[model samples]
Target: MLALLPLVILAATPIVLLLTISTERRHALTAGLALTGLVGALLALPTAAAQAPRDVTVLLRVDASGLAYAALAIVAAACLVVIGYRYVGAREANPEEYYVLLLIATAGIVAMAFSTHFVSFYLGLEILSVSLYGLMAYFRRDRWGTEAGMKYLVLASASAAFLLFGMALIYAELGTMTFAGLVAASPEQMSNAVVLLGLAMLCASIGFKLSIVPFHYWTPDIYDGAPASVVAFASTAGKLGVFAVIVRYFLLPVGAVTSGLTTYLVVTAVASMLVGNLLALLQTNLKRLLAYSSIAHMGYIAVAFLAHGPVAAETVTFYVLGYTLASIAVFGVIAVLSTEPGRTSDLDHIADYKGLLRTRPVLGAVLIAGLLSFAGIPLTAGFLGKVYVVLAGAQDGHWFVLLALALSSVAGAWYYLRVVVAVCSTPDGESALERPSVPAAPTAVLAVLAVAVLILGTYPAPVLAVIESLHR
Candidate 1:
């Protein structure tokens, strides 16, 4: 079971390469690669569950947590492939290179999930980050793409430096870089000063990756500048990978060093939630709104993290999985709808959606489902996810955090409902009521996502059971 991990990862390479070979072959290659990766990942799941937790080396470990996150990444990647099929082919960019980068990024995310040591974690992060830089700037001729790439590179490089320095401090104090070793060496061999400083740096570094409050300056610009498909990848898969590592780190018992970290995290979480939602209310562009929305969503996940217990871990994992699925679904709709050649995701403007129900009822319905899920409406996966997170927070006696969450939810409703209202509004122009054509592949993708959202919401037991079994 353990032996199949590397094999599954390697299997994705050939098809990813095929995506770049020629225009005529791009769609088939991308679809094949996505399907192959999904199957390989799913096949590995039972084995991963059956096998005892194994240490591949000091740097890599395969545990239930890692397996869960890897599975989520693979699923999200598969959805993105379907969402991107039409957009990639229509653009002037090389479809093959785009898919190759995506596969490499997926591999990096999986690697990150299984990493047991700082060295492996950094390696996985760098691989994912570098590929994303190119993916962000894939439309090189476009100013938005180029600017977004540059901003991402500079900010990401700075964060990487901080992360390396923090790792060095940790290693110097403990003489080991592995998480297990660090936990074991604490108290007697490690001091509060070293641990606190190291953790602070680590928080700052990861904050950049997760787009948390102070380090979130780059997210909106990048999301607005990049194509919708790339933004989708960054928002869902990239964030989940970082959260997987963050959960592992926080779950470790580091004694007094971690004593007040929960309070600090709770404060940041509330701040992010308030700030992200409030700022989003003012944004006219769809990409920027979603970017801010992503920040707010991360804050909710952080609330679960601050709860700091077995239930917290379970809640966080479930929330991340549900949120990732919903984001992919929402972005898939955006990708198909925002397919105009020169435009970015700005095409998802509220006004652009006016009379969408009249024009494209099926697409409009799918969009409504996705938006309602994001808004945490009843009978949607997002609502269940929020309930779990809020319950975890309340369990931890985080009344203020719970209050902040409630307020943010109320504020969030305005923007999401605005879109729905636009979709149902009367069309003023002739083209406004004209149905937008979505190909069979994208239509099928939307259908699958819509079904998954409903299923996860109505009968969340199966997935929740799987999450419950994933204890460290």
Candidate 2:
């Protein structure tokens, strides 16, 4: 029962918020309730993991990996909710309901993190997709928001079709919906043409959710259209949840039985790295730049995915945590910069950041630190992440992908440094932008994220030990 606690708490959060909707302090009350629910979920993690590898149901598996990713998803969601308080409160007529949607989305995320069966995975994916559709279009008055939402809906529905067809094909061939059943099959059964095709389709659909290249067309537009806080949740919590399932699937015994699948992953990883970074260099918009960078980062994680060894899971976990911290920090700055209601976000133009160091030094420093981490500079969490990726690639002797990763990071550094330079540049005149009054809560959250990055980069042994223990 303790193993079920996190999911129970997450599922109940929206209802708890809905019940308090009539309260006079509804906005503050809603945020507080949502945060409390996330804290409760985090608190339940140790108990959940202590009884390691428990099957909660046919659909859910409570295990170390699930527990770890659940913690990451919930933490990322909590950070976004904190940052979104001002953004949602100002423009939303029914502001309290926004927390309801967020918590509900997080519930889907948690489900995906713990899912062990195809049925559970599809349900969780649809739940997350549906919730995000509403959150993206929350600011319906904006044309960009409306258009982004529609585009995502159409593409996401098509992706779901691919996934379902793939699942159907696999079931027809193997007559199994569970990973254990599939892995138990003989290698000859696993290598059927239909099964391979089905696996390809599944990979494609998952690739779309992770925003890797070729399936990543919707990312920049969606990121640009959505609120910064929501983007933070989508990039970190949403992607990490999907990756959790992939991690489990790859760790299965049958994973090594498919050479064709391994080759397909390698090609896609290289394509994502090259394309994602090249496209990012041409972007002047900060949101779009980060969106493209995320694609490359996903590809980098793929290297670890392809490496079969004891450390593969830990490497992915470390890289993801580093990326999560950097993304949260970057989007936190964007949320703070976006103070106006019923207007475009303030993070759109590169020029907007000029003289930011002089006007908002704290945010300026945070933004630079976050960007540096993203660029894989030493003394930041991202550098450690890249080192692990390199180790994984070398372990697998994947020289081509390793070279691609190196070149992509160089490309990434160029664009990231451009932003840092702009931030330090002098304003042409008295900066026309009004410095938005900084909220203590969001500011404090950003500070914590920045400090976490530094600490993780400086001394990763503690967290690495924990990840090794969990996956061991």
Candidate 3:
């Protein structure tokens, strides 16, 4: 119960601040709330890391996997505070509601990390999804933002319906909603038709969250319409929550049915990799490019889930850490650089970035580093992350999976390199767009993220060790 305090605090902070703070001081209130949440999470770190697994209830538990995910969400939220400092302050819209929604969203993420039952999972997911509807359309003056929000709302609600229906079916068949209880019940207890149909629906719901192919229509539009800071939050933090739940649901009590699901996941992952990267080549907008890239990256991480072993867990965690850092660094830069009054993201066009090195060398360098990491260039964290996934898949005799991943990597290099080319290329003096001014906090955030990415790329041993330690 004590170990769960951090989650409680995280969930409470936003609501508390929203009620207590006056509108005039909302900015400070928001930052203070986030800071409180961060401190609470940090204080719980040692407990979460050292304590044994404990069941809070039949439907929820505290364990190492949840701890890892909670920590990631906390860190990502802290980064959001820094990156959003100026954006929140400068905007003319109501800052109070914006920050309140952000805190609620963060709380929802933490809840998702700790959920152990289908009911709790659905509750956490809806909390996150509902908050995101507001966050996506925070800039209501913009038609694109409102349109994106509406689309996300419709798609997300439909997915939720599918998920709930699946859960009802599973409960009907197994007579339990708790993960442990479900695993304890033999497959023979349920009708094969019900099990298959429920699992397929479950997959569809999660696929929508993960932005996998056939269910990824909302990603590009939402990413392109939201502010860069919000996009960053959605891409990394939101996906991490979904991945945490997926890993827990798939990896528990390892069995034949889980194995079959893993096979399906592998096939979907391969398709996402090829389709996401190839589609990215046609996008001129940076947000859309990264949106597709995110789908591809999810596919890369999905390969680890297909492997199903201690190595798979470690691989997924390491890959997620590297990918999240790269995303934060890239999006942080975009938040700062794209502060134009009306734009959602600065990496709007390759042409817009020509000669960026001359005016914003630090941002250019960070962008280049991030791009290289995404491309899995040697000696980068991305390289090690990719290697782990490929090795894990190959160990399990997933040959076609390995081949598709390799070819996708090669194809991915084209668009990633195109960004690099634009960054390095010199443009005519008059044609060069003047580098926009960025404030101190966002710049500091980018600097920290850049350094983190570089350090992780060069010396990934410590992070890998932490991931490997979760095998127990």
RMSD of 3: 2.0
Which residue pairs in candidate 3 have backbone atoms (N, alpha carbon, C) closer than 3 angstroms, thus clashing?
Answer: 381-457
**Which parts of model 2 are misplaced by more than 4 Å?**
22-25, 254-257
- Candidate 2: deviation at residue 447, Å? 0.9
Q: After TM-score superposition, what is the CA distance of residue 312 in candidate 1 from its true location, in Å?
A: 1.4
Q: TM-score ranking from best to worst?
A: 2, 3, 1
Range of the 10 consecutive residues with the lowest summed lDDT in candidate 2: 249-258
The superposed Cα distance between candidate 1 and the true structure at residue 279, in angstroms, equals 0.6
Task: Give residue 192's lDDT in candidate 1 (0 to 100).
Answer: 61
**Model 1 regions more than 4 Å off:** 1-27, 185-191, 250-257, 341-346, 430-436
For model 2, state the Cα shift of residue 27 in Å. 1.4
Question: Number of the top candidate by TM-score?
Answer: 2
Best by lDDT: 2
